[model samples]
Target: MAPEVRTNVNLKPYRQALALPGLRPLLLVSVLARIPFTATSLALTFYVLLELERGYGAAGLVGAAMTVGAALGAPLLGRLVDRYGLRPVLALTTVAEAVFWSTAAVLPYPVLVGAAFLGGLLNLPLFSVIRQSIAAMAPPDQRRPAYALDSMSVELSFMIGPALAVALATSFSPHLTLYAVGAGIVGSGITLFLLNPPTRGSDEPTGPVGPPSRRAWLTPRLFGVLAVSTACTLVLGGTDVSVVAALRDGGEVRWTGLVLTVWAVASLVGGFAYGALTRPVPPWVLLAGLSLTTIPIGLGGGTWWLLCLALVPAGLLCAPTIAATADTVSRLAPVGARGEAMGLHGSAITVGVALGAPLAGAVIDHTVAGWGFAVTGLIGLLVALAVLPTELRRRRIAADHAAAERAAPEQTAGDDRKQSPTVGGPNGELVGTEH
Candidate 1:
């Protein structure tokens, strides 16, 4: 007899998801590919500062150029992927990125700045591809876990990537680190391309037919998901700034790194636990939890150890919120447009961090450091609460429209009966319809 497939509501989802054909390799390649992404900015900063002997302002400008490039590149590259398929896009980007970095190390400061911008613009949309693939391949029930796994991989990359860059740059030369980064990108990109993971099914479009509809895949629900993701990350950025400032104030600057690591670990653990469950928490609930938990963190500014404990609740919500947003995007985004959707999702995150840190820093400079955490938490909570009413109204309208559609056939049938001509006698029994 054939063996029966194992099943459990709690544990089976993740197991089954991993068991899906071609998923594991894709996941592995995705993680490896993204390591360079996390490493690049830090490495670039060090490179410009140390090797080129540029000032912080120049380094900052170069970094900003990269960020701008990434923001612009994502949607454009994603659209290309949707139109032309993954392999060609990945192939072109891989070649371009490899060449860009290889040449960047030898270029002058003026040229390096422009090169950085181009590199960012042409950076392979690895994260977008992976998320889109997971959304496409995983069963609907298994997606939460799949996305959660993806989020955890991202967390791990963040944990390792920057540190690795710093270690390599500090120990060896920054030029060597740049070369290593370029090599990593090329190697990972080639592996993923050759593996040829199933990004979309046969039904999905491989190329564009004509101009897209005016009301395209970016629906209101998807917009809401992106907005919530941005808000959550913004809060995270603010929290980071506050924690560092508070630690500095308490003369526990040395403990700041440890505290942040612990905070990230909490988020990683939360992602694992959230993914294991059969049911996942809603994005709004996670957002609320994140905001609520952060409020108490500001209260611990006097004691660094106390602040570490306060960070736990907010940190726990981090990965889950990210995972939940990914899941939401999967559900809300239309089939052919998922690549662009995922691209937009990543952009939202970058934008959030870009906005949050500076705004929070400004707040800290203007007021006390502790107020940064408080204001960040409050902003997140308020945003979530404010969006709730609009979301509710949209959902209600959708439900009414759906109900009307369901009732439409019956209403049409009834009207037809009322308008039908009667061939029978005075009893008013309708026997025939009008010719």
Candidate 2:
């Protein structure tokens, strides 16, 4: 008999992914956990600027310290999760976060910078953990929608978290605001510790199978995905700075929040639609489209609303591109090393954001704000172009290797048959003798 075909024709993709056990709670907790994580940077900036009475340059330095620490620490933390399991790593990071946030409000400038770096080193690996959990909870076929939902939740968090942080900082003392943000971060960590979502899928072994070496899973294809991820965030980060600069130049800086809100909403809508697609879109294609669309945004810098409208195309690609990258990483990484892979993905994101703001700021300093968009978009497009050939070559090699492997078995069977002696029976039936 032929194999049976099972189809979920009536179920929506998001619904199907959500229907899986543990996924809903996991996603909910992830969103909640990420809100404080998102707020930390803004809150720290406010504290440095308002409470410490420092210049923007000093604030930028503090932020840079944290960014550098996170970039360096993410992969190491991920490796720890892979080896020691989730709870221990979470606990350790949680304690570290608690210590930093509790004392951050009182530290001197130099001390705070060092503390920020240390705090970032042990920063709760919320992004990686959430992604790793999604990969664990959702099957390969269902992962796109799951990751899409994850991306949307991230957008939602960013929309809410920084705004809330800013509000508290403005309304209350920056010192009090820092305490509240700290409380939120510590709370998120504690919650994650208690929840302890699975990092490996059901099909994947629970116990240590001994993770493969880095070279085994970190292929050129994986690097390409990471590069695309970095490029995507670089564009986003530059766009952020450019938007503010453009608005300030137009004397409509007050409308900055509205424009950004529109952009975020567009991304949410795009993520929703992308999740429902029957087939996956490649990350490279999405990145290229994002870059292409982003390049024209500067043309609309004449007005805030025009900029908002111009941002729609690139915004639409944001969540989908991110979701696609996460999905690709999950597919590429070995189960044993997925935590590390996701961590590296997080590092790529951090590096991109770190680079984007400065690069865009430098451009906006020397040239017009509009050129910020043009230059950043051009860089992203160039990167996408550069990575395309490598990705294609990798796919071709993988295909050839798969085909050769498939052919080997058939070839061996044919050789065995040919080597066997054949005889004609009395009834004219042919019989083959085994060697």
Candidate 3:
């Protein structure tokens, strides 16, 4: 009597992801986390400009305050996750966020900055925990797709949050909008607390991750990844500066917000599209492609026409590059230390962001106007080329290892049959063992 039996093959994947008891909860929790975190990029600049009587120059301070807190938080949180399970620590974070945001909402200017800094301290760890949760719960093949979908979700959130925040803060009170953002953050932190994600860390772990995590920044591969990711950030940062300056030079400074929003929106679409690829490309290929595409971003001068299209490629590049990085981190993580790994990965990103704007600004100050874009694009291209051979080797190694694992069981069974005691003459051991 259930409405005409429908054999629906399309529901297979949805069914599977849904079948994961915790996925929906995690997704819901993630939505809550994203709204406020992204709102910072969207609203704070306006808050400073409009309410605090600060000019555009204050934007840098706001960004720096948040990021420096986050940079310091990353390692601390990663260490926490390594010591305690993700649940307890994440719960504490949510409570901290609730307190910080609520107090910041009513605080004075100096107090507000302090709150923002503390919020940053509490913020960056959320995403890393979420990443670790996905790795813990998802099967091998689904892990990449899950990460892809998460990236897409964040992209979509960014596209929406910034544009909407700018509009709402302008139309209404900036304080009102920021308060709303604070509420959104608290809600997400609570959600994460409730949905205790699957744990990869064991009670009796194999590695040395229990009490105090070792000073692992000395590891070579970790350093290498940071270098690569940091380079990518510099390219993006430079591109941001170049476009902003070019727009000002062309007397289209007002369009800066609009152009950036458009770029974020395009990236939202591209990330979703990238996630949908049937046979997902390896991270290296996507990385190289993403790096090369920076050419358009750097080259698109303030010609009104190029503004619309130049950033599309850059936006499009965002999700794929991140998705690839997520994959690489997953593969690189130790069995029980994914949370720490993700946090470290996040810190690298923060380092990149912190380094990027200044690097671009310096290049622009001393050089030709157009050199900003050209230099950034060239740097990206060179990085792509320099890393290609290493990436190729890594991929080859991964493939070979995968092949060996797939063949191991069959090979083991065959060997067992040959060496196992046989019943050739009713004395099972004599024929094969000769004992």
TM-score of each: 0.87, 0.92, 0.77
Model 2, 1-435: lDDT tens digits are 999998654348888999998999988998887888788888989999988899999999999999999998999999999988999999999899889989998889999999999988998999999999999999999999999999999999999999999999999878988889889888988988888899998888886667789999998889989999999999999999999999999999999999999999999989988898899998988999999999889999759999999999999999999999999999999998999999999999999999988899999999999888888898889988988998789779899999999999999999887776789988999988777
Question: Which stretches in model 3 have alpha-carbon errors above 4 Å?
Answer: 1-19, 55-59, 105-115, 201-219, 253-258, 278-284, 365-370, 385-435
Residue-level lDDT tens digits of model 3 in 1-435: 678876533334444654665766776667657766777755777777777877766656776787888877876887777667776777777777778766654666676677778878877377777777776666656665567667777766766676677778988978777777778777776666666676562333633455434354334455456556656666666777877777877788888878877776777666666655556665445545655666555456676458768778767877766766766676666655666777877877777767766766777789744567667766766765676676667669899999999999999998787775665656544565533
Off by over 4 Å in 1: 1-9, 202-211, 401-435
Query: Model 1 over residues 109-222: C-alpha lDDT tens digits?
Result: 888888888988988888888888898788778898888888888888888888899999999989999999889988888988898776675556555534255277666667
Query: lDDT of each prediction vs. the true structure?
Result: 0.83, 0.91, 0.68
Query: Which numbered prediction scores highest in TM-score against the true structure?
Result: 2
Higher-TM-score candidate among 2 and 3? 2
142: Cα error in model 3, Å: 1.4
State candidate 3's TM-score.
Answer: 0.77
Residue 156 accuracy (lDDT) in model 3: 66
CA RMSD (A), model 1:
5.4
Candidate 1 Cα lDDT to native: 0.83
> Candidate 3 lDDT (Cα, whole model)?
0.68
**Which structure among the candidates has the greatest lDDT?**
2
